[model samples]
Target: MMNRNFNRRKKFIFFLPVAVLIVAVLGYVVMFLWNWILPEVAHAGKLNYWQALGLLVLCRLLFGNFNKGGGHNGFRERARGMRAKWDSMNEEERAKFKEEYKRRCGGWGHHRNKE
Candidate 1:
């Protein structure tokens, strides 16, 4: 079992870069294909570069994780708010949380319980 695990790790180490390169190449090919298809299929109303850029931005706005007001953006905003809550806590609350954390965690790096 150990030998098999070692061989699997070695195989992954050797193949991971190759897999990434293949994925990158495939993405470029797909992009080129999309560009080719768009102009050909919509000959009556060809989308210019800015139009394509706008579509890409819109798609990203709708589907991407970083768009504001939702998704990762909202997640990030919530995280920031949480952080602010932590930061804005009065000294008593901060001290209490520290006490609770220390009591639960047995003091960050120390193994022994406070006696």
Candidate 2:
């Protein structure tokens, strides 16, 4: 347990600086792009490094996922659950489901030509 804790601490110490560097680089990139592009095209004011970082945080809070695994695992898990449910359905149940889905959704390829 002590060794495991030491390893964890070492990994955290190593990764913390890398993570900070990455965030700092992203902030600089945001600042550069905003300063370079928006001033001429959008007549927007320039952002300092801290403002750029804040904007990044704001955008993330508004429209981004904060999941540690980058937010796709939840989708995969849901898809897996759906597939399992589908596989567990009997033929009659599956047919009924398909019919109901078609009725509700107007059927797939509803706009396609029959020919």
Whole-model lDDT, candidate 1? 0.70
TM-score of each: 0.34, 0.63
What does candidate 2's lDDT look like per residue over 40-87, in tens digits?
A: 999999999999999989987776655575646478889999999999
Which ranges of candidate 2 are over 4 A from the true structure?
Answer: 66-73, 79-115
Candidate 1 lDDT over residue span 1-115, tens digit each: 9999999999999899997676566555545656778668876355445555556557667877433554554677789998999999999999998888777778557785657
> In terms of TM-score, how similar is model 2 to the real structure?
0.63
Q: Candidate 2 at 102: error in angstroms?
A: 9.1
Runs off by more than 4 Å, candidate 1: 43-115
TM-score quality measure for candidate 1: 0.34
Clash count, candidate 1: 0
